[model samples]
Target: MNSSDGGTATPAASGAPRSGPRASYPAEQSAGSRRRWFVGLSVLVVVVGVALAWLGYTKFATPDVAGEATAYEILNPSTVSVQLTVTRKDPSEPAVCVVRGRSKDGDETGRREILIPGGTQTQIGMRTEVTTSKPPVIGEVFGCTMNVPPYLTQPAT
Candidate 1:
């Protein structure tokens, strides 16, 4: 085509060459792309959240069974004879049992290790004067696995 000034103005070809700014994709297409990206991000967040919750539940919800052993008074200090019992159930291999008693002021008055099988009950006997000004409180009575040989080996079968 020719302008009035006789300057040639080329017409855009059928496979048109763009003039000025190129046309943008339609609003619906851009919005759909954004929606898809958001949905993907949301799905990723949900998956990560569920995984973290499962981990937290497994880690924190389970109770610790390692420190379950306890001590009970077989005899008070007034008697000339005293007997104590320590029971361990389903203990790990090579377990060490420790029994500690504390005074009212939180002092370690006495401690002893009772010998017993891993999944059995053992009894310990002690005789001491009941001369403490304050009654004793059993502080800790628990068993833990130790990596040492038993002081008194069990008799051969």
Candidate 2:
């Protein structure tokens, strides 16, 4: 059958099967599929950005060292020594370090308190001798503490 405008009737009116891609599906359904794909892509991009930010924070969020242990010497049965390289990020920040020694049995044999004056240099190397109760087989640094200890003092003029 033909319509009043002289065009062939659609499958619904003529009762014949439709042909071609657009005729197979409705326009609203195709638009809905496109919207779903766009939403899925947007979610994937946000998840990837969050994951990258977390990785960056975990890799770079720790404090840096104030001082580092450079070397040590087990001089004699009664004495041990350690060499430390101190760093002062702030010129007024004093440095106090605890140097320790260990015996052959892996027991602590000695510990010494060291003080380095601040406002002089960014990095300084110092050596201090430690008294030991027994012969120390090795010497190591426990860690360095910022600022001066209570017992340190300067002589009065």
Candidate 2 local lDDT, residue 72: 78
Model 2, runs deviating above 4 Å: 1-65, 153-157
- Which RMSD does model 2 reach against the true structure? 9.1
Q: After aligning candidate 2 to the native by TM-score, how far in Å is the CA of 140 from where it should be?
A: 1.3
Q: Which stretches of candidate 1 lie over 4 Å from their true place?
A: 1-29, 61-71, 74-94, 107-116, 119-135, 142-157
Q: Candidate 2, clashing residue pairs?
A: none
Which candidate has the highest TM-score of all?
A: 2
lDDT of 2 by residue, 1-157 (tens): 3443334567535766544554555646578888999999999999999999999998776422255668878788988877888776664666777888889999988998777776657778888888889898877778776746677656535
Q: Write the per-residue lDDT of candidate 1 for residues 37-114, one digit (tens) a residue.
A: 999999999999999999999888733223333334524542111233432333443344455555768875666554
Worst 10 contiguous positions by lDDT, candidate 2: 1-10
Go through the candidates in order and give each one's C-alpha lDDT: 0.47, 0.74
